[model samples]
Target: MQPFVDGRYNMSKGRSAEGFDSLLVSITSNTGLTGWGEMAPLGSFYSAAFAAGARAGIVEIAPHLLGEDPRALTRINRLMDTIFRGHPYIKSALDMACSDLTARAAEVPLVTMLGGQENDMADLYKVVTHGSVEEMIANARRIITEGFHRLQVKVGGKVHDDIERVAAVAGSVPKGTVIFCDANAGWTTYQARQFVDATREIDYTLEQPCVSIDDCLSVRRSLNKPMVLDESVTSLEEMLDIHRKGAADGLTLKISRLGGVTKTRQIRDIAVDLGFMITVEDTGGAEVDTAAMAHLSLSTPEERRLHAIAFHQWVTVRTATNAPPVIGSRMGIPDGPGLGIDVDLALLGTPFFETSH
Candidate 1:
């Protein structure tokens, strides 16, 4: 609905200003309950996924779901995979819709449907978009002033400049505040080590410093700070391997990246069992996406849950009413049935196609 940027976050994946190309889906139950789902690609080049591909895949796979039970989430997911292998983002919306439908059918919230509520709210982290050292420090100051103790600083530029930007922001924030230097897989193994060495005096987290698993593992050996993985972590198998290698101390779990909440929570459970902290979120979407993320984060153990993002706020328009607000430094969640919010279909526009049996 809106093209927005939070500083250098748009640049991390070597993309231009990014826009939300979302596919909103609805699955209606025989009992008259409706569930909504959304899948929005960060950018055409950010990942292996793109909006056009997601829509085309949806068109191909959605008809197969017309006669199936909406509550059979695992079955539905498997059927989609059976019909269309790969392209996890394509099934993300359908999977989300199934979860919403199942929760509504049971008269419970999505979190309760997943299991039960393990938390009510989630700590929020603000992104410090790319800019000069001075500009970045100014942004960090304002973010900290807004009560955000956790910050994800965008780095991965020139090593010297990135070091300067990271050090400046780190020096400005108060002690005990969590600072994560996210390179978004822009750095090489050598660059990752250089940045880590330069910032050894500062206490901050490193995220996906290099693109490859081996590259990240190499970087991991050179530093004592906790490393968080994002781009390289797209599958359960990859997560298990990372755990086996002890490459990540924390993980950035995107619901869309992992397909949907089912696989996302599956990976989350694996992380918790292994004692790795997590940041439950999605690539990007409006209210529906945020609500789904909120419920998932809410159901995660507090200690293991690093923070959840209100991605809708990054969008210029509002898609759902009654979504949790980022007040102070926490995003509040409402305990209501299903997604617990109403979708603005008018803003979403008319559906491209529909079918019923």
Candidate 2:
């Protein structure tokens, strides 16, 4: 059996600077091979489920890897897919951990193995606040001065309010910088369309303006500016559909959201094939995903300026002493064994292991 440690970090948001944390996993094999991955949804309860998922994935998949060559990762991933159906996220998390170990054993970086090189990076931005026009502009000003022209602002649940939210954030950014408003599915089609119409004359993208993909497309077809799908596109099939139907012109690809790097790459291929924009961003906060997300986005050619990944460690964590994953003005692909990150195990607080037979 392998011992996988979880790093739970409490990070605050720059916009709100509220304390947010996530559970990151460090899976170690008996051979001293270790791979890193971040589990989804931040909370103590979410960590419990993430731990459960990791244990389940490792217990079921690790044995097959015992005598087999770890370099045969493709075969192992395929086996996991076939053996454990409908567990892509959990499987992906496991695959990322194992891939880190495999590449380290071979002394090769994960990017090269996946036919990738460190290039094209993106600057990450987070949703600051939901308030009056002046307040939104103030937040936008602060973000822009902090080297973030790319932005994502929040909107409450109301048609009138959503419109104001869009206009306010748009007016706040430096003349040419990009800005996007995340309704987080807080608007109705009619309400979303009003805001989408407003976006046509601005310098930003619209994300999850409405509820489902169906509603999103309904609004997107009537607009000139492209839309980005996040909560809606959580899988390969969803990505294919969005690209085929033109429901969305871009995507916010988070490794944790789409499982891990393996499937995240698959989604990237799909997006690239359809000539759609792809942004490899993280799910927010101090999860190990920040590093993995940076590497994945930096490695992909299509995700250079289109991606929004940056140093949020300061606000997220009190002390971000680790040189903040810098990649160009935005973020670039990192070169190293596994995710090219050295995790300090001692940083993780009390970690407990739970096994499932």
Candidate 3:
């Protein structure tokens, strides 16, 4: 397990200590080529997934994938879905490995497979985990000094305390900094309304203020600032439903949550056509997952991309060599083929489960 640089990652619903569990999956073809994938759930409470559950799901599904062609992503995903019902988190790593293998086979970067690179560099946003008013402000300032102009401040505590935290941070930050007050679905409709109503004059976007789509829509109606939905959006159908109801001005596209790059791309294309601002990222991972997020974000049109996260920067471990570097507030993808990084097998240790025909 890797430890977080910030010691603990405290969100609205759960807290992660040391760090979260990161699962690294590597697939090797009979021709002696390998592709890598990773999945890291923040915490059990944060999503409907857990590390052990993902492992169990993989054990139940890996045998069926033994002889399938890695390049046939759609068919592979369909098989996994047909055999296993709804554990997208479990299928994410396998889907990612297939994508990496396909791109490597074509001798092109993963972004090329996903509609090409629209922008080589993607802007980043730092999360200010839930903390005291003073602590949160200090974290915000520290992140700004690190050259990140976009900040996603975690709120969703007591309604009044959350209000103070967001207001204080907004006041402390320099002008032109983009602030996103993300509640992570921690509030009720009444609480969300109160928070937005109290902070109406502040210049910042409100994100996932309540638990349900109906509640979020109610909050969005009163919110003057842009509203972006996360956690609550998991499938393409949900994305369409939210868009149809005009519930959100933007959405956070988490690769793992949406299954993997395959489904994420589908949703992304539609989101682009529908004209929604997007923040492309993942649930969490070291290098492999970050690479996938970066490639997808880079392929997205710059004008519509709000920001993407360098999740590798959050952890104090190395899973791959030559991972994409974060230069100031922007990050550029590696020019190499596939996910563009070399996994350090020595660090990964022995696989808990392995199968071959």
Best by lDDT: 3
TM-score (all chains, Cα) for each model: 0.96, 0.80, 0.98
Candidate 3, residues 1-357, lDDT tens digits: the string is 878988988987555456869988888888888898899998787878888998998899889999999999999999999999999999999999989988988899999999889876898899998989999999999998888899999988799999999999999999989999998889999999999999998999999998888899998887789999998789999999999999998999998898988999889989988999988888889889999999999898888888989989889999899797788998878768999989998998889999997
Q: Runs in model 2 with CA error above 4 Å?
A: 1-21, 42-70, 79-87, 118-120, 198-200, 285-287, 302-305, 311-324, 327-329, 333-335, 354-357
lDDT per residue, candidate 2, 1-357, as tens digits? 111121222211212223334445556666767676554443323122343555556566645555555456677667777777655556655666766677677787666665566564455664555666777688678777767766777763566665776677776566887677676666789887777665567766777877679999998888777688877777888887787777887787766566667778777776776777777764444435565666666566754337655534433342112323563346543446666666666666565542321
> How many pairs of residues collide in each model?
3, 11, 0
Instruction: Evaluate residue 220 in candidate 3 and report its C-alpha lDDT on the 0 to 100 scale.
Output: 85
What is the TM-score of candidate 2?
Answer: 0.80
Clashing pairs in 1: 7-129, 8-129, 8-130
- Sort every candidate by TM-score, greatest first: 3, 1, 2
After superposition, the stretches of candidate 3 with alpha carbons farther than 4 Å from their true spots are: none
Q: Which scores greater on lDDT, model 1 or model 3?
A: 3
lDDT by residue (tens digit), candidate 1, 260-339: 87889889888888999988888888888999999989888888888888888887778778876667788866556887
lDDT of each: 0.85, 0.61, 0.89
Model 1: residues with Cα > 4 Å off, grouped in runs? 5-9
